[model samples]
Target: MNLEDYGEGTLASAPLDVLEDYFAAHGWQSERNGDEEIVAAVKGSWTQYELRAVWRAEDRVLQFLALPDVRVPEDKRQLVYETFGLINEQLWLGHFEMWAASSMILFRHAALLDSASPAGLTLQQAETLIEAALDECERFYPVFQFVLWGDKTPQEAIAAALVDTAGEA
Candidate 1:
């Protein structure tokens, strides 16, 4: 979790070394800051995401966070919280949370560094997690907007955004 794990003259940590390679292969702009963390910018349909992946060797956990390009207003914090709870209920993988200090909604997922992924995680798993995070953000972005500015309740906002369509409109 710190520079000590990386040792002198080491550019990156073990798990993050693998993740750094994954970022490079995809041509995403990423910087492995020191060792334990890598921050990348990824574009989603709805907005750009600031992707942060952290490797905690002590706990054998890889924490991933995708932050959608929106900031919740102070007045709508309560509704945003409620909508996020509903959104979390519908999600099977990662969940949405507000980083209270910034009021930024984030999609968070964690993976155990196990035998399957010796380097904390594999590229395929990373792809899946990233896609899921982006998809969820794209789908729910408008709902957040509705609650914040369109005079819609949290339930109403979710209902309006979640309706399924048959084909291209």
Candidate 2:
């Protein structure tokens, strides 16, 4: 099925349909806000996350932005920036970036799709991409909470949040 089959006024042939299918299979709340963008709200251990995926067919890139929904204050921007660098270092895929305009921290990743493939993206590929972003978001969520609300230094936040607890507490 193509985009046009979804409804009237929508056009055909976009890669994000695979992403939309992923959302449907998982039963998460998501919507296609535009021809190339889909936003999904997911619940995590620490907070609600907004996952946004954009398909750029011309570039054959499906860009994803995962938001933990915590706003960084102006004063904490420097520490947040520092923590972002630290957290991103440990991430094998994707990275953290601060939107200076909105004082928002976001996790960004992208998948290079095969434009030649009519299927665009497979369901497995969609899950892998989206899950990896969310996993990163959940893993380091406390670091942001520490710096933003607890007023901890970047070093302290990372240290405290990443403590490797063994067995059941």
Candidate 3:
């Protein structure tokens, strides 16, 4: 029910439980969607995104996906794609993609958890990955908005996003 219940241990064997507890510990409302999936919603300053953590037993990896509420219109597909290319390169951990068939955009990352490896999952690692995905979503959300609704060119949107704001501080 909580992080305290699960003492520090190798998560290679119980990644799902570890992840569920981790999300719960962080006060994120989550529920098991099926045997190997947990769906959670995280709110950002711009919007809320649904984060899904799915354990692929066959591959021994935990795949996390975040889908923002923004949808790319057919006409804006090229602009959105161009914007994602720039954003994806800047990402160190995960990548963003536009699913044309679904007309949805998602941020995705994976953590390998080979049971035989000495390195096991840690709360810090999981947290870092999840946060990275969310941070990417938050950072690029406005760019997508600019392309989708603000009638801004992809180049313009990216330039606006990359403007240095530390000086404003």
Candidate 4:
């Protein structure tokens, strides 16, 4: 659907707006940029840092865009990988990782609906929506699997199933 359908200046044009409001209700000020990015304060049990959500909508399709956290580098990407594991360990903690984890869930679930059985989505005319969504989720790292297994790789069984179903969309 186009932004206009949601109404001018309405929250419909941006999913991040919903997320920002959700965070703000919890006492956090979610700063948005260019209608595509959101950065917020994250409080750990004993520490705090800025958490960011970089997102984009292109060709009327939406995906969770990655933030350019320059503070995180190549060597630190490994640290972020390990941080993925650490986040799993503290899944219940209210932190940036928690938001990431939650965001992953929301996106992936919507992707599933978009791809396998849109049911009633207007985009059903576009058969590749599900595959596109899965492709994006896979690229972004399936946080659900990361949380459950502490690894970025999908389970062999799931990988094989996905591969088998790859063209079903």
- What digit string (tens of lDDT, one per residue) describes model 4 on residues 1-169? 4323444444423555544654576686668776656666644322343444444444333433222121333333444545445433432312223233323222212221122222212333222332333243343333433434444443432343334344555
Model 3 CA lDDT for position 100:
78
lDDT per residue (tens digit) for residues 1-169 in model 2: 4433445433333567777777887888999977689999999898999999988767778899999888888888888888988888888999999888888889999988765556567667787888999998998999889888998888999999989988996
**Among these predicted structures, which one has the highest lDDT?**
2
Mind giving the per-residue lDDT tens digits that candidate 1 earns over 1-169?
3324444444325667766666788888999877689898988777889989887777877788899878888988999999989889999888999999988989899877673333546567777777787788888988988998898998999899889889887
Question: lDDT per model, in order?
Answer: 0.80, 0.82, 0.80, 0.38
Ranking by lDDT: 2, 3, 1, 4
Q: How far off is model 2, as Cα RMSD?
A: 3.7
TM-score of 2: 0.88
Query: How many times do residue backbones clash in model 3?
Result: 0
lDDT of 3 at 50: 89
Query: How much does candidate 1 score in TM-score?
Result: 0.86
Candidate 3: list runs displaced more than 4 Å.
1-13, 117-120
Better of 1 and 4 by TM-score: 1
Using TM-score as the measure, name the better of candidate 2 and candidate 3. Answer: 2
